[model samples]
Target: MSQSNQQRIWQVVSQIPKGKIASYGQVAAQAGIPQAARLVGNVLRKLPEGSKLPWHRVVNSQRKISFPIGSPAYQEQRQRLLAEGVVFNKETIAINHLAWSS
Candidate 1:
């Protein structure tokens, strides 16, 4: 993706509240580029360490963390969400109950 598009993705991500989670597709749509969910993931993956953006506040459309199980990324994501009081049902979250209302 272009730098502008990536910036737009980051901008949308930054708006996600601390206790809320947004799907990749929802972030893409909010950034005005529908169907760019994978692109959003890519941009998020490339974010520099120590970046202030709330990258952890994103998940897949299934309300599941995108990182592989047992991976450090997966653990970190789950830990962060848990710290924010987000409840999970196995690998998936309750999307209807916790999805952010823009």
Candidate 2:
């Protein structure tokens, strides 16, 4: 069930605290779908309006915001993360700083 999988991924993502972030792979693994990291991302990309999921807490393996700067999603994600005290360096959320441990 796509809806179930998306909900599961969101649950795992919600566990990440403010100012912290998880790799999509890490969230997928935590959600019992270790190979579905990209799926997690895809599902998140489909989240509808008013969804309360903390999707901004999920990033790429390199702890970078993979969304392009010109995209609205990219702006929202960056703003949300920054509001949560996440600091970025040279276009990436410094992996050394925000990478949440498994």
For residues 1-102, what per-residue lDDT tens digits would candidate 2 score against the true structure? Answer: 355777788788878887788899999999889999999989888888888878898889987887986588788888898888887765677533646534
The TM-score that candidate 2 achieves is 0.82
Instruction: Look at candidate 2 and tell me the lDDT of residue 52.
Output: 82
Rate residue 6 of model 2 by lDDT. 76
**Per-residue lDDT of candidate 1, residues 1-102 (tens digit):** 456989899999999988889999999999989989999999999999999999989999988999998799999998988888888777776544655534
Window of ten residues with lowest summed lDDT in model 2? 93-102
Q: How far out, in Å, is residue 37 in model 1?
A: 0.3
Given candidate 1, what's the lDDT at residue 92?
76
RMSD per model, one decimal: 4.4, 4.3
| Most accurate candidate by lDDT | 1
TM-score per candidate, in order? 0.88, 0.82
